[model samples]
Target: MVVNEEGDILLVKNPNRGWEFPGGYVDKEETLQHAATREVREESGIEIQVTDLVGVEQISSKRLNVFVFKGRPISGELSLSNETWDVGYFTRGESLSKIKLERYKERLLRCMDEQNTPFLLES
Candidate 1:
């Protein structure tokens, strides 16, 4: 999750996933943090400096593993990519309503709360 100085969380609208944090599969020879930074830039046109790993989620059924990180925007303006229909920063409350999926919503909430961060979950 990337948060701006105003405390607005960054989000991207995906065709399949609606509104969610900007992310994608890690490329070969790329670190998880590097992938996160690249994905954010590609999807939202925002360069971010990742601060810490917020959580890790694995879904056995889908053979999917995701590393969620907390970050701050370093530069760039909000722009849309082919992968994302829209991108913008929103308040925490607005972000909750914009992100409809429970799994994604949970991640955002946990990342936003310092006490509940750095979590691990498998499903």
Candidate 2:
């Protein structure tokens, strides 16, 4: 997931309930890093530079690759695409309730808890 200089985490409000990180399934030819960057731009109008791999989670049937990125809002105003209804930033506490996926909240908390160090996972 990507966070901008304002200390707000980027979130896409899914139809389900809460908001979500702007990312989707990886394309066949694209690398994971590129996929993350593309998905962020497509979902939210902001351009980002991915910096690090944060953590990974294996859900019931899906393998999720989560990356922690320190990015700047280089260009584009916020626009809601087909994948999202609202696109905005939220503080860590605000994100817990704002994020639609429980797993996402958990991951964010994990990242926050490990702020001083870096986290990496395989598989």
Candidate 3:
């Protein structure tokens, strides 16, 4: 997730997932951090400097593992890509209300607190 100076969280409205942080699968040629930065830029037109690893999520149903990161925007403006229907920054309360999926909400809540050690969630 990318947060601004005002502590607003950046979110993208995925057609399938509703509202969630900008992210996708890591490329085989890219590192985890590089993929995170690239996905944010591709999905939201925002260049970000990833600061920390928030957690890892294991989706048993899909046999996939998602690496979540916390970051701040280094530059670029918010714009939508084919992967995103909407892109914007929202306050903590607004973000929580905007995201409908429980797993997505959990990721956001976990990322908002930087003090927490990296976590692993399985579902």
Candidate 4:
């Protein structure tokens, strides 16, 4: 998940564990982009526009659907929902240390380093 000039990647602090991108399982028929956007909004209360396909990754027991996009903050103030504890942006280094999901941290760094290229998935 990506956001504006602040370089703040939208993140949700999961109640069950640590921080993660605001994304969930894709519905049977929903496109990955749709899922990414919906998940971000649902979890972070921040509506974002998904611009490009970032990448995908599979870890341990789950298949992660990662989509890196340019998001413009549409509306809604950040709030902690049932699934998330906090929602905000942090610097790349900060996110690396603060993000709870190890895979997400890896992907975030990859996305940043490869921002000029198309999405590429890593297992």
Q: List lDDT for all candidates, in order.
A: 0.93, 0.73, 0.91, 0.72
TM value for model 2: 0.81
Report RMSD for candidate 4: 2.5
lDDT of 3 by residue, 1-123 (tens): 888999899999999999999999888889999999999999999999999888988999999999988899999999999999999999999999999999889888787666775888888
Candidate 4's TM-score reads: 0.80
* lDDT of prediction 2: 0.73
For model 4 the local lDDT of residue 56 reads 50
Top candidate, metric TM-score: 1
Backbone clashes in model 1, listed as residue pairs: none
Q: Is candidate 1 or candidate 4 better by TM-score?
A: 1
Off by over 4 Å in 4: 58-70
Give lDDT tens digits, candidate 2, residues 46-110: 88887766665544344555555445566777888888889898888788877657767766776
Model 1, TM vs. native: 0.96
Q: Per-residue error at 88 for model 4, in Å?
A: 1.1
Looking at model 2, report the run of 10 residues with the lowest lDDT sum: 57-66
Residue 22 of model 1: what lDDT?
95
Task: Assess the local accuracy of residue 95 in candidate 2 as a C-alpha lDDT between 0 and 100.
Answer: 83
Off by over 4 Å in 1: none
Candidate 2's displacement at residue 115, Å, is 4.3
In candidate 3, how many Å is residue 54 off?
0.9
- Candidate 4, 84-117: lDDT as tens digits: 9888887777778887667667667777766445
What are the clash counts of all predictions, listed in order? 0, 2, 0, 1
